[model samples]
Target: MNTGGKFSDAELMEAIQKNEGKNDAIRFLYQEYFDSLSSLITYNSGSTEDAQDIFQEVIVSFVQIVQDGKFRGESSIKTFLYALARNTWLNELKRRGRMTQRNKLYEEGRDRFAVPPSEAFENREIRKQLLAAVGRLGESCRKILALFYYEGQSMKEILEQTSYENDQVVRNKKYKCLKQLADLINNDKIIAENLKQIDHEQGF
Candidate 1:
C-alpha cells in the first residue's frame, strides 16, 4: 500500500478508474500543477480565485476523460491539461463578453494540434507586437482594423460600420491601416529597448 512510488500516468489513471487511489493521485496533481496553472491564469487576466476555479474545472474534465476511457495517447498529459485549462479560461472570458485578442491568441497557441514550441513563441511575440502597433494607429484606422479582424467583419460590414461609400474604399482603408500598424511596430524603438531590458533582467 505504499502509494509513494512514481507511478506512470497510466497507472495512476487506472487507480483513479477503480476508485481506490484517486485521492492520492489527485493530491499529486494538485501539488504538481496548482502553482503553474495559477500563474498562467493570473497572467491571462484572471485573479487567484479565478485561477482556482479554472483549475478545479480542469481537474473535473481530466477526471471525466480518465473515467470514460477517453484519455487519448496522442498528446502528453501536460499538453492535455494546458489545453483544457486554456479553453476553460477562454470560455469564461467569452461568457463575460470580454474576450481580448491577446487571450484569443494565447488559447490558439495552447492548442494541442499543429503547434510547435518555436512557432508558438513566435506567434505570441507577433501578437504582442501587433497589439502594440494597433494601439498607435489613429482612431479611424484602429476601429477599422478592430472591426475587420477582431469582429470578423466582411468588407461590406466594415463599410456600413465605418460609413465608407463602397467596398473598395473599405478595402483600401484596411490596407493602409495594416501598413501603418506594421510601420508602428518597425519604427517604435521604445519596444525594442524594452525588450532588451527584459532580456537582460531575465538573463536571457
Candidate 2:
C-alpha cells in the first residue's frame, strides 16, 4: 500500500475501489479538498458546521459510487467531488425551504455594486465592535474563535493547537464559544444598535 504524502487521482480511486489504504485516501480527500469544498457552502449562506456536514455526506456518497463501479473515470475526482458537494448542498437548502432565499442572495451577490463611502465606514465600525466583542470572550473562547474564524484553521488543526482529546471535543468547545459570542453581541446595546442599522441599510 502506497501510504505516501500524496496520491494521484488514479491512485486514490484505486485505493478506494480496492479498499486498500481507503482510510488514507479519505484523509487525503479531507486534507486536499475540505477548505475549497466547504467554501461552496460557506459562500452560500451556510455555516462552517453546515459545510462540514455536507462534505461528510459528499465523501460517503463518493465512496459508495466508486465501490459500486458507477463512477466512470471520465471526470477527474476533483470535478466529481465538487459536483457532488454542490448538488448535496442544494438539496439541503431545498429541504430547509430556503432555496428561494438562497437564490435571492446569490443574485444580490452577483449584481451588487461597489460599496459607497458611508456604507464602507459603517462596515469598518461594525467590524471594530465585533472584534471588541470577541476580545471580551474568555481565553478559551477567544483562542478557538481566532483559530477557526480568523486563522481559518480546521477543527482537526485546532485539536493539535489546543489540549482537546479529539476533533469532536474541539467542535463542541467551538460551538459553545460561538454561542457565547453571539449572546455577548446580542446583549450589548451599542453593538445591537449598530447591527440593526446595518441590517436596515442592507434591506434585511
Name model 1 segments beyond 4 Å from true: 112-204
What TM-score goes with each of the models?
0.52, 0.51
| Candidate 2: tens digits of C-alpha lDDT, residues 1-204 | 668679999899899898889999999999999999999889987899999998997897788778877778777889888877776676577557777765656544331222123323344446557778989999988999889996789998999888989999989999999999998878877777777888898799
Alpha-carbon RMSD, each predicted model: 15.7, 14.8
* Least well predicted 10-residue stretch by lDDT in candidate 1: 114-123
> In candidate 1, what are the lDDT values of residues 1-204, reduced to their tens digit?
227546567766777777667778787778878898878899999999999988987787678677777776577767777777776777678757898888878766656552233223323345456667777789999988888886688988888777788999889989998998878887867666656655676699
On lDDT, the candidate that comes out on top is 2
Position 58, candidate 2: lDDT: 82
